[model samples]
Target: MNRTIAIGDIHGGLKALIQLLKRIDLSPNDKLIFLGDYVDGWSDSANTITYLIELAKQNTCVFIRGNHDDLTEAWLRTGDLNEQWLQHGGQSSIDAYRNFTSEEIKEHLAFFKQMVNYYVDKENRLFVHAGFTNIRGVENEYHDTAFYWDRTLWEMALSLDDKIPTDHKFYPKRLLLFREIFIGHTPVTRIGEDKPVNMANVWNTDTGAAFKGKISAIEIKTKEIWQSDPVHELYPDEDGRN
Candidate 1:
């Protein structure tokens, strides 16, 4: 069987990603699809992106653009952005660029722009950084905010009840299509776990790598999920749960 592995949000957890990859025993024949947010929240954003780019060049890797990636790319392009990025783990991303020269930054930004918004297979399996509002519109037709930052879309896509339509506008009854969408943005308790709503056909791969969770990846064909534990010390907990 062809093995295509879709990785969850890395959040700059290069060590954890590497560990999970080893555990999966990835091979040249296997395809790896990264759902985005490759940088931020950890200490190795630069290294993570660099390695992922290299992987894209040499191996079967599909890199999708995440919300955080869009923000970082904006900073890299315009050299100025809102302070909201800092509150949402942008400080670590900024630190990642400290060592790179202006030329290198430009190169990275260009690479970021080239990333595809989504990936789809003939089997109706869609891979997007975040869920889409309407699946009927032309691909990549939605705004960047909807592509990366829209939480409502995610909620709607993951809603189990069929009462929530995939598209706001109705199309031909024969054209009604429900493709299984694989996404990463909202971190769930674990990877590969189906959402509460079963009708959405959404798979959340973010295992809270930046928080108190692990990094995760899942095989598209087999639905085999793999994860790596946190490599660093955890923040002190006032509740004494640690």
Candidate 2:
């Protein structure tokens, strides 16, 4: 059967990405939705972007922009580095592109530029890199950057009592807006989970491939999960954003 899969943050772990895909045994009909942060952590940022570009040609895919993607794109365009970005994972991305030609860099920039902030499908399922703040929903959001930067939505979901009925007046209006929300900015690993965590209707797929966790993917319909070995294990020679 055709499947719709939501994948977690990559953080340039090309090997993990490859492993996850192989385990999924992808079919032409399967739709792959990648929560971003495609770069900034591992050493294959440029190559990972190139692979995604090519992968799109062979299968259905949706790419959502992440905060890291935003930061990396800014550096690519201005050549100005953000100190915090470098310390976090930006240096790995920069070094990854050191061997690329100007034309190649341009291609990668175009790839980043084309990523969407969020995607809502026919099923009313929301796919985004991070949470949105607007109670009214993404279209009425006051800031576009919030799509890839906000963490309050997930935090709110986590703090919810879980006893509140959906129809209760105090229930979060934003949570009621979509059938489900899939995000990837806040790593589930931070909360002591190495797999996807579902709080209320929001599913956080960022299993922390950028740090010590493995990359993960969840089948939207089946809730079945597939994961790669810990990203740190895959790249034993390098410390990934640790």
| Best of the candidates, TM-score | 2
Worst-scoring 10-residue span by lDDT in model 1: 233-242
In model 2, the worst 10-residue window by lDDT is: 183-192
Query: lDDT per residue, candidate 2, 152-187, as tens digits?
Result: 999999999999999999999999999999999998
List lDDT for all candidates, in order: 0.71, 0.94
Cα misplacement distance, residue 2 of candidate 1 (Å): 3.5
- Using alpha carbons, what is the TM-score of model 1? 0.82
Best by lDDT: 2
The alpha-carbon root-mean-square deviation between model 2 and the true structure, to one decimal in Å, is 0.7
| Candidate 2 deviant stretches above 4 angstroms | none
